[model samples]
Target: MPLLRMFRVFVCCVLALTAMGVCGQNSLANQTIKWDDYTYKFLSTGQSAQVFDSAGKVVGTILSMNGDLQMIPLPGTDEEKLKKSFADWKAFYARSHSAGGSSSAGATATPAASSSNGGPAVPCPSTYGVSYFDGTAWKTMMLAVQMPKEKSVSLSQGFKDMGKNPLNPRAGETMIYRYKDPAAPLTTGPNPSFCVSISANFNPSQIMIGTVDIKKDHREIEQAVSSRDSWLPPKRVQQVDIKRVSETVVVVTPKTPLPPGQYVLGGPPMVGIYDFGVRASQ
Candidate 1:
């Protein structure tokens, strides 16, 4: 047989095998894992402590953040990664402190606000980018962070329910994202809006989006996280009135500063235009 033909045949077989493994897999609450431009890190204990993105992809690992502090391997990822995540956050806080460690400058600010307001240049400290909906279109701006080598193992095991590990807290910890409002409603008159949703590789665990309503808009546009057990976010809706500049252009400013660390935007989902929609106004 021709060598070229044999190579083609081998490639076909590999593709076929991969498709079979994915096609019949159990549905974990109708969630799909997207592995595009996304990679995870494993911590010292052979678990994943964090996931970073090179492209504008929503690659999230099971982790949390308090202020600028990233909650590394809850109890078990990298004994060092957890300590490092905390250490990095502490150092960041120390630098931003005017007198105390509290930053009055704000952590995550929207480009629109930063450009117009003469404030310190807001950096992309979070893992993911900002997502927006303009009724007719969706827009997202994302930034990916690099994972430390020591935490690679923990980052991997964190997404799986592999019995009990010495590092992670439970089978899977709560995965968090910076959820933005879907510009248009799912239905025209009265229905669930096309809100951004999230999922993880492991079972039982879920993504949560928490929102807070800063403006007295009858619609409570707050930052929130979504999980099977509950949906949460550290802050409430700070702003509303997401501007749909064009069909695919949606711009919003978060009402409050975003928590430090990595995050992702879920969607610029399909929806209609109207003043009733919501946006994450930082």
Candidate 2:
């Protein structure tokens, strides 16, 4: 009878342990949500945080209270698709705000400014200190800087150029560049042009612009970006025309038009590499 009782107790303990293990696994799975190539972990505060791929690594704080999660695209994400996503989110946000419903956690129900082109005017996050080129002049917008605790060395040269400006007296700590109209039609030219405002301290000779060889596999690209040792190699190092618009502003244009692929604009020692894409004109 004693032996039987002991065996029964052991069985109960085993069952309890098994149940606990399943519960723990469920909890872990519930805590993480994988969206595309990125895995986002829910914080204790219920906020979903995403880090930007730039020099001053900005964190996008998303409120997930109402189960409606709106987010900015991760760096190296297809820019063309992101524009559509942004538009959809903006519309949803606007409707929610109009209905007096909470659109995002901690976000007030304020209507976003309407754009001249009949699209929702999405304000850029001020945390990254960004400006945009409006065809004629560079206009500053959403100038806020939130520096990360651990300084990242992987910010692209283009990001660095946009963030660290000396001329703008009212500029924030870190600078970023945004498109005036994200949904603007892609430039259908022989070569697409990218412009950057160079700081006085930056050495023009160290700036290197080349096409990046992105892997066909999304997992491979994510792994390459995450690993410090996995610096993706650049192909066809061509000389680009570095036209100086001002003492502080310079435009780097490739001599030949880039084929439809991913590219990087930065220099050797490979610390501040930036990523851009060339999509087929639609």
Candidate 3:
């Protein structure tokens, strides 16, 4: 009888151990694992997973098989890096503008004062020329003063007549033009009129103008420029208004100017596009 009791006790111990082992395996199967700079949320054991950044943005996707983790990084996953790039550009523009030096046309400024009374002066040449309606006046915002090379050829004599002929044609680069009124309050509803002039001729159907999510990275901008896909999943746009101003100029006027954020204006494959920003005045 003592031997029989001993056998029964041993059997009970084995069952308890088996139950514990099963529980432990279940717990591990449901566990989220952290690897390198990403946290992996397991959708299936040894199958599929999602990787996320600290901000909970899906930075990558993971496939686990045979105890191996294969990670695929999503384009524009580096949000912080993109933000820093924007900040650096803004700082450089600020420094150059304050110093009254020639800089990229990405920065926005009011017309320089020609007189003490702040009367209108000759519009500055901007890489991407822009015109906007400021509720009361149709003001031209000139970020630079040099006419583009293509435009210069046609206006050489006209420029000479003004006595301030452009010495050299300014080779234009891809740029973003911004317009903001310091006195205007932050607005969510469409109110301000904003327009941009592109230097290329493109089909109106192929042209897309949309607001960009500053949180996204440069890859998102590239995608938007390519026009292959809408950047940031759902395209952020208030409304798109594009018109053919001339054979060489395609004007884009957003129904309402983006409040204060990054935006993109481009054609399919992003042949010629501008990525610009709007900052609210302090």
All candidates: TM-score: 0.18, 0.29, 0.27
How would the candidate models be sorted by TM-score, starting from the highest?
2, 3, 1
Residue range 140-232, candidate 3, lDDT tens digits: 553311112221122333344345434434322112222233122222223333344444433444555566433321312212111224422
Q: Of models 2 and 3, which has the larger TM-score?
A: 2
lDDT for residue 158 in candidate 3, whole number 0-100: 36
lDDT of 1 by residue, 129-238 (tens): 34333334333423222122121123444455444445544544433221234222221211111222222222111222233232232222222112222233334222
Best model per lDDT: 3
Q: How many backbone clashes does candidate 1 have?
A: 58
Give the best candidate by TM-score.
2
Which lDDT values do the candidates have, in the order given?
0.31, 0.40, 0.42
How many steric overlaps are in each model, in order? 58, 7, 4
lDDT of 1: 0.31
lDDT for model 2 comes to 0.40
For all the candidates, what are their Cα RMSDs to the real structure? 24.1, 21.8, 22.0
